[model samples]
Target chain A: MYRVKVYVTLKPSLLDAQGKVVKGAAVNLGYDEVENVRIGKFIELSINENTKDVNTAVEELCSKLLANTVIENYKYEIEKE
Target chain B: MYRVKVYVTLKPSLLDAQGKVVKGAAVNLGYDEVENVRIGKFIELSINENTKDVNTAVEELCSKLLANTVIENYKYEIEKE
Candidate 1:
């Protein structure tokens, strides 16, 4: 079995209202030293088959549907245990 | 130093149109075995200060802003290296 993890984040040039809210909360909670809180997405997928093409398949998955190239960027990693 | 990773995901009962799109791509790519591709978010933050209050601070951050309690759920793990 394999576990695939994907992270999705808004483009750096875009305004992340959600991250702004978190930054505010961090400051209020005394994490005044923390900066740049950008909120994004994470996905974990479990695959039963062990195929050599999994990585490419997943990369295609990200480019095609899991991420929006115009506004968001995605990075993924796969692990086997 | 401390690294905090946060994961956010839509509630299972909620509709995941993004996941649906990924599922379609998987099918097209011959991943006929792939199923139920729900997407979420992951955040990594670095803290230079080693304080006992960090976890509480992070929890407060999550409750206050890092996650939307209404439609999303969040889980975070902290690591020091």
Candidate 2:
């Protein structure tokens, strides 16, 4: 069996309103040391396949359907057990 | 200073092509136990300010910029040292 970990995040140019809101809340709660908030995503997957040709197959999947190349970025690690 | 962590993921219904590719690769690589791959994002931010009054402000910010309620999901944690 194999496990894959993926991460996606917004481009630095885009504004992060949610991070700001949480910052505001922290300050209000007397946790005024907080400054900025940027949010992103994390995903983990388990694949059932032979380890021989998984790399190329995985890359194809990433380009075709896994991530939206325009707005988000993605990276992944593969582990075999 | 405070740190915020955010995670975003696809709403299950959407296709995860990246995951499929990874699975295929694993199978070919002779690691046939791999099954699926789901991709997501992770974000970390630090705020430098008085710890008071940050909560409300943070929530407002989240609603305005951080996450897209229509598509993504988010959560956060605060740490003080």
Candidate number achieving the greatest lDDT relative to the actual structure: 1
Backbone Cα, N, C clashes tallied per candidate: 4, 83
Cα RMSD to native, each candidate? Answer: 3.7, 7.2
* Candidate 1 A-chain TM-score: 0.83
Q: Model 2, B38-64: lDDT tens per residue?
A: 655576767665646656655644545
| TM-score winner | 1
Candidate 2 lDDT for residue B32: 51
Candidate 2 regions exceeding 4 Å error are B1-34, B37-41, B47-81
**lDDT of model 1 at position A10:** 87
lDDT (tens digit, per residue) of candidate 1 on A1-72: 777888888898999898777677677877885665777778766665656688887787778767788999
